[model samples]
Target: MRTKNFVLILLSSLSVLTFLDRNAISIAGHRITEELHLSESQFGWILTAFTLSYGLLEIPMGLWGDRSGEKRIITRIVATWSLLTALTGLATGFVSLFATRFIFGAGEAGAYPNTAIAIRKWFPLQERAKAQAFVWMASRLGGALAPLLIVPLQMQFGWRVTFFVLGGVGLAWVLVWHRLYPSESPLQDNTDQQQYVAPENDAPRWTVHLKDRNFWFLLVMYYCYACGVFFFISWLPKYLQAGRMIAEKDLSYSAALPFLLAAGGCLLGGWLSDHLVSRIGLNWGRKLVPVVGLSLSALLMLGCVAVDSNVAAVIMLALGLATMDVTAPVSWAIAIELAGKASGAVTGAMNTAGLLGGTIASLGVGYLISWTGSYDVPLIILAIQLLIGAFFASQLKVSTPRALDKT
Candidate 1:
């Protein structure tokens, strides 16, 4: 394979590693809560701790990656998070676990922004959405695999040992990444000149993005999208086993199905976005896929709430998640399209908003369930949030250079 493609594959693997680490906690949620003697709300706070720190640290990490180089930043990220993931297994109570998860979130904060920067530096604009698709698909694959993998390990070795094992997997990836990933582009002077390697421009400041209206819209849209998606990653497993009373034997398969379905959604979203851009022009191409996808996602989520059978409900939830994910790559592409050279900073800002949404959703769902005695209310709220995201997506100005100024 070409070196650039090789780099893409490695970076994509990092994406998978990230989701595996992040989702592992949720996959082992039942065991953790039982061991710690924690209430549902307290467990929710544990998840929130991670997301809050992840959101708050995103911009700094993104800026650092942009200035210092993603290779070094990514190296630090993997090492820190891996160590923290191991420490997570050592937590004795709520405070210790929350602190560990918060720091772990900080460690993992800049991963995707750095990945976006790497994509911006390495791939052509036309191919970026598809590249992002592969990265997200890998993440979904990791998420899909997490329940299937973690549950069996937890059943065999206990949850603490299962976490220790997951931590080791990341450390191994770090060794390969440090050795193989080149900081500079391998295909710099090739025929892919359309892939603008954003020139260094110290003149225009990063604050320019703050004043851009479209940037805020993108941020809001991403925030809403993340709220809906976060519910699945942070709460789905427990929601299946607890809220819906799914059998433990069925929990792993049920939890994994949505993400597995979402893997296909990412590929479809990427292909559709690229195809539409070529045939109908960027205006409709970029906006249409997300608009349609998120809208359908909203409808499907509502279906999840309305269904009677646990099996039918899980299937609806899986379809809803897949539909929502169809917009994931497109959203990242919009960030890259709007930010240009500062893809890291802009995408980081957008992700910050998104994770903030995730933080809120994580905390809220716990209380929402505790208060209401069911998942129905929270699911309805998330469905409404997806609709709001679709509205923002429809308003995006992707075709014009007017969305961003040339630095």
Candidate 2:
């Protein structure tokens, strides 16, 4: 239990570093834009570069995690993304920065899917949601904490040096992850007695997974969700400076408000989902939380557009993000459970689709802003996607074996 908890902490820390490194660009977006002599649309293209690559590669990397050991793949991914992030410091032009960031996104594409596979490997059914929540919260916490850390660092060092330092931190984590993770699954460990008692299998093939209807539905839900999230990740800083006319100092902490709230939602959702599942059973556990979460999320999203002040807008955004996060753990939890021994592969596919959604949302929102010259217009579009997400999540059919319901 202690070691598993340690592993969780490490996973969470890495996620924090990932968000910190990525979001650092947002914190420095104003300066970067001026330094590079960039047009607003060109800046959008910079983010699109990363989003496009990240979305395209999520599934392939996730599948690799499923087939190759999660520990190994995750460690390598951390190393790879960190290296690319560091290279971002060396970029002198929009094209150079875009390429580096895009490559960084590709390396990061499988992080959550791999984390899902790790949870499936290490945690029991009863604890999976909490474990996933821990994972999700850590990532959010990283984002929340970024302004505190990265903003100060960027101020002290130039923004470029900040990226280099953040990248170095990731390299350190890779060493630790590689050291801690065992070569084989913990279930297969001779020291442990818990047998997952593997589900009955019929000569495993990728085709069996590819044919499932539930899988596609989940994919659709994730894609929609990703669109909303990517919008936040890509546009929040600009939104603060442009949309709200916030000062850089306030922008640092205020930008984090939504993420801080989201951290709580991530934990709350995970803990609640697991408890509900344990009490009710898989069908109810799997379906109930997501339906309610996505529905409420849609309402809150629409609320985000209605707010007049930056304070109100971000607070509403926080609530909207929290409501959506309420189902996040369950989403990944279902993917791993349904995947069984193939957790990595299925999770990867779901994430891949989500990334595509993120890519579309990122680019689409930018174009909306460019065309309409108002953040609210693009945000309205995002709200509509959330509505669709709610519908998809409500109708989702998660396939878990009846016998495993109590597990």
Candidate 3:
């Protein structure tokens, strides 16, 4: 493989690893609840712990990536997070588990921004969206692979072993990454061919980026979208089992179907965005990909809420998630574009905002379902949020092209 593409694949594998670690808890949720003697609230907290820290640390980690080499930043990320994942296996109670998950989130927080930075360094502008999409799709594939592989592993060896096994994979990835990756430059010949790697400009500090209305718009957009997507990830299997009357054994197959579809959607999203940009222009392409995806998914989500049968509901969900994926790459690519060289800080902040919404959805949606006696209410609420998110996404200006400018 070419050095550029090889790096992309390695980075994509890191995307896979992060999701594998993130979703491992969901796969083990049932057993963990039983063993901990926990309520639904506590189960929600288990998920929340990871997201809260992960979201909170996103900007800092991202800034770290932009300033430092992605090689060292990613190495640190994989090592620390892999250790946290292993520690999660050994947790004795709620506090221990929550702490480990939070630390795990902190450790893993830098992965995406670092991946974004790496793509910026390696890929030409023409392929960036497709590149982002491949990484996102790989992550989804990891999510899809989790239930299929981890659940069965949990059955055979126990949940703890499942976690340890996954952690081992991350550790192995770190060693391979450290050995194989070259120190690639972030810029090429920009002005009159005078070029070498320069230090990242300090202009995109948190305070400055946070103050921008456009930044906040993207933040809100991601948050609303994350809420619904996470609601499904955290609760979908239970919904399938409880509301849809899908059998316990069948839940695995049914639950995985949407994620598999989600992987396909992610691939389609990146390709479509690139195509749209090439055919029309960047601004319209970026805006329409997400706007269309979210709007289409919103309608599907409303239908999902109203549908009665398991078969039909699952179909609607599959379509909804696939449509949602279409905008996934744009959400990421634009963050870096807008932030310029400080893509790390902006991307992290943007992701952190989304995770805040997701964390709330994970906990609140659970309680809402408990009180309301159905997943329908929370989903209707989420569908509305998706539309709001779509509105925000539609307002983006790809013509700005801040990424191309000197800071």
Task: Write down the lDDT of every candidate, Cα atoms only.
Answer: 0.88, 0.77, 0.81
* 230-261 per-residue lDDT for model 2 (tens digits): 77677788888888888877877888887898
Model 3 C-alpha lDDT per residue in residues 284-328, reported as the tens digit of each score:
877788898999999999998787778889999988988887777
Error in Å for residue 195 of model 3 = 14
Least lDDT summed over 10 consecutive residues: which range in candidate 2?
A: 197-206
TM-score of 3: 0.92
- For candidate 3, the 10 contiguous residues with the lowest summed lDDT are 191-200
TM-score-based ranking: 1, 2, 3
**Candidate 2: segments with Cα more than 4 A from true spot:** 189-204, 401-407
Q: After superposition, how far is residue 247 of candidate 1 from its true place, in Å?
A: 1.8
Model 1 weakest 10-residue run by lDDT: 194-203
* Tens digits of per-residue lDDT for model 1, 1-407: 38789988998899889999999999899999999998999999999999999999999999998788889999999999999999999999999999999999999999999999888778877888999999999999999999899988888889999779889999999999999998688333444453453333222445687877778888888999999999999999999988898876778899999999999999899889999999998778898988998899999999988888988998898899888998899999888777766777888999999999999999999999999898899999999999999999888777333445645
Model 3: lDDT of residue 353? 84
In angstroms, give how far residue 290 of model 3 lies from its true place.
0.6
Please state the error at residue 250 of candidate 2 in Å.
0.5
TM values, all candidates: 0.96, 0.93, 0.92
